[model samples]
Target chain A: MIKELLTKERIIIPLTGKTKEEILREFVDHAKELKLIDDSEQVYNRILELENIGSSALEKGIALPHIRDNIIRNIFVLIGISKSGVDFDSIDGELSTIIFFIGAQRNDKKYLPLLSKISQMCSYGETRESLLNAHNVDEVMGVISNWET
Target chain B: MILKGEKRILIPIFSEKDMLYLIKNIEKIDTEGKEFILLRLIDEQMTKNVCQRLRRDPEEYLSSIIDSAWNNLYYFQEELTKKEIHSKVSLKTGNALNELIDFGKKTKIKVILFSRLLDSGFEGIFKEKLLKNLLISWEETIIII
Candidate 1:
């Protein structure tokens, strides 16, 4: 599961962006096509759905959006970084430049393990710091693959 | 454009059981593409007054998640029985609206089908205007239940 969930396909860091919603929308659309997700309305609703409930923002300009809707099989992750910052509706009222799209299947056990794994990845101070410093695709990919070595 | 030739269809399931139920009807659904996605929503018991009745028990919560997800995939073989649709499942957490939109955008999903939570809190607040902002401008399909 981690092999498929943490592949290079969904990792994007050092992403350039100017708008809050535009960059995120672009990130989401790209990830969906490869996976063949057909519930745009449901997907859209779930994002706004989470916002109304609470923002998924984390510390030091990071936000993990984990919505437990079985839109795609298994847990999906998309890593996006915006140097310019974004209005992420965060609880801290800070500009969110980095976002990770966390998708999970609640009915089964994948959500928790992946969430723990992702959460474990997030807890790494060095990982977050480099992911923030990554200047290009290779640099970003390096930060994404840091967990191994 | 990467999936320009991929076949797309939205399979929205309520609970974990809903997915197993759909397996019985997979043959009738159109599956003429290389990939078929089973978009299932983990409908939490959330009303206007969520009440926090389901207190956060980290271990138990995680256990339930694992149980459902494993079973869902184990039984989705029928989804592949229909030729052309390469079946796969995605799991999301929390409310349906945000979960669906995030899934749609991240997956570049062309369509969305969802069940409307007709609770009192959703009355005038959630309408088409809100949906416009929530949904990506890409081609989409909406099924309101």
Candidate 2:
């Protein structure tokens, strides 16, 4: 299910963002550029609102920032990897290096389950290490493909 | 002071059986104009330890557990919807007791419905201590079923 939303085009390696806001904006802009969403500003604002409520940053250098709204026509996941982690206020007080920005239609039944899948994927130390070691988009895809198998 | 408004209820589910038990006994609770939050907390430390002991990938081991939990929670959410109960599902990974307390406090949950089944074994001592601590730490009403 995650593989369907996360394609090679959606993966960004060595993201240049230094802060959480910058990282989120980078992902939102990329989604707009890829024609995945109509308005980058609206999407970015909505994501920030959710972040204010609670940081999406999880433990072990991973963050899954997501939103479900009427504006989203379908579920889309944009993956961003940063070698230099950003402080995203994670529960474990660790920087987030891998961010999975997810947008889903308000009524999409797969929203929560998709988040669950991503969380499960990031739970492995091996998965995080492999993703960090990935040199390009294909390497990232390779890691995900290996996980799917 | 009497508080009269929408009261939110928190149900912390640890496994499929806990969800099933809640679904079976959901009718016992008053569901009028109440919001329910179904939460599942995955223990990261415990999972990592298990993976190390068994020499298994944490992703593979956690995936199976999380998938089953998600399925059960989705089913329980549907059942609640059928009865006109508005609910949200939350899946988190952290210290189970700390996460539960933090979530409950952050959401301003007025009540918590706990399944007695979860308190039985699978870190029974830890859960036993957690229950005791919850009663002591939280001002919200806790119903152990």
Candidate 3:
């Protein structure tokens, strides 16, 4: 599921930031460039909405920035692994080093299980460590690919 | 393989251990053909054995906060698959059975699965609540898993 959704087409590299907002902005810019979203401002608004509702920051050092789409046909996934963890407002309040952003259509019911897959993969120590050390976009993709299979 | 589907269950689990069990079960099951019933067992409170008259039950103090949390969890509309498991925590207000019936109607859920994991702490508190509030129509599909 992640392999099909997460590829070079949706990935970005070397997103520099020391703050959560800066890092999120980088993600927003990439999403806008790829036409995955209408605009970066919409992206910001989405993030705000998610935060206002509930934090997607899960257990461990992972945060899944997620949103539902009514217009899109397929699920869109973005993989971002930060060497320096960023605060994601997680339930456990852990700084997030690994992030998986999910954008899916509301009618696409397959998204949850795939999300479960991603989190299960991340739960593995070897897989997570490899993701953290990933140096390039392809490397991150490769890491995810390895985890999924 | 990734559990690929559109609708996943929204279960607001109370015990982390139970959540792990459900997650593991999902892993064993092929989710390619089915959707999920996301469930949430309202945590944040204890179902103590101390019970009293209807008006003095713990539900009075708890109904609001629990309902609020359940709604908050409901706002998570993110889906990764086409078919998935979905369930939710019971309402924090009114009678438990009635709350369940009302939520079931609103969500259009056909089944309500329960467990004996919780202590019968408040004597027949949960039982009474279900008897009083349960919709007569729901009797056919209630699953005690």
Candidate 4:
């Protein structure tokens, strides 16, 4: 399921941003350029609202910043990797290097399962390290697609 | 990893003993400069025993028990907030172990703190099951007793 949504156009290697907000805006703008979403500012605001509720920074330098809004027609994904890492307000207090920006419908059934799959894929250190060093989208997808659980 | 600033603690509240244990241990932790979040999960399975023993409707029993649990949680939240710790509580239904894993994955959790019942009874059995599942599901995070 994750592999299907993740295409070459959706992946951003060596994301150019310094902070979490900047990274999110860059992802949204990138998605807009790909014609995946219509509005960038609206989506960015919604993501910030979700962050106000709670930070999406997972352990081991991974951040899944997502939003379920009426504007999102399908479960879309935008992947970003930063070797320098950005302060994403993670509970572990570590900088997040891999960022998964998810936009889904409000009542989408596939949202939670997709999140679960991604979380499991990122649980292993080897997979995360591979994702960090991955040069392209296919390499990133290879790491996630080949992972068990 | 390096959990130096904000700390997210997952607390699974099973019985009064678990609640008391958390309250007692909260003071001992060095929560001086770092922000703290107390993610409390009120297990629905623990209330199932009460429903079976009392012979009440499952829905009604769950609602009543959850209300009581919220009261206790709100009280704890108020007290913890006084100590500069943010408290967020959730009422979980179905398998307690699976629910904990789901909640842990959904949130950015750093540490999990649960109580071990000192006796070889239902509490001990329940804690063991939860601990086992937690160990299998959450390998990166820290677990505290």
Rank by DockQ, highest first. 2, 4, 3, 1
Q: Is candidate 3 or candidate 4 better by TM-score?
A: 4
* Model 3 ranges off by over 4 Å: A71-73, B1-145
Which of the two candidates, 1 or 3, achieves a greater TM-score against the reference?
3
What DockQ does candidate 3 score? 0.04
Give the range where candidate 4 chain A is weakest over 10 consecutive residues by summed lDDT. A50-59
The estimated TM-scores of all candidates read 0.46, 0.63, 0.52, 0.58
Off by over 4 Å in 1: A1-4, A14-20, B1-145
lDDT of each: 0.55, 0.79, 0.55, 0.71
Per-residue C-alpha lDDT of model 3 across residues B1-145, encoded as one tens digit per residue = 3433333222323333434444544445444544344444442223422223334467543444343333333342232121233222222333344445555565555544443244344423544444335445465354333
Question: Clash totals for all models, in order?
Answer: 52, 0, 53, 0
Cα lDDT of model 1 by residue, A1-149, tens digit: 44456666676665565654565566667667766356655765666555433345544566666566677566677778878777765433567766777666657556656644554455467887787787765676666565645
Over the true interface, candidate 1 deviates by an RMSD, in Å, of: 13.0
Q: Please give me the DockQ of candidate 2 compared with the native complex.
A: 0.13
Candidate 1, residue A14: Cα displacement in angstroms equals 4.6
Predicted candidate 2 versus true structure: per-residue lDDT over A55-135, tens digit per residue = 577668998888788877788998999999999776456799999998889788888788777877887899999998899
Candidate 2 residue lDDT tens string, B1-145? 1224646778888777778888888767676666677887677777787689889999888767788676566557656765656666667777887889888877677778887875455545556766888888888788877
Tell me the lDDT of candidate 4: 0.71
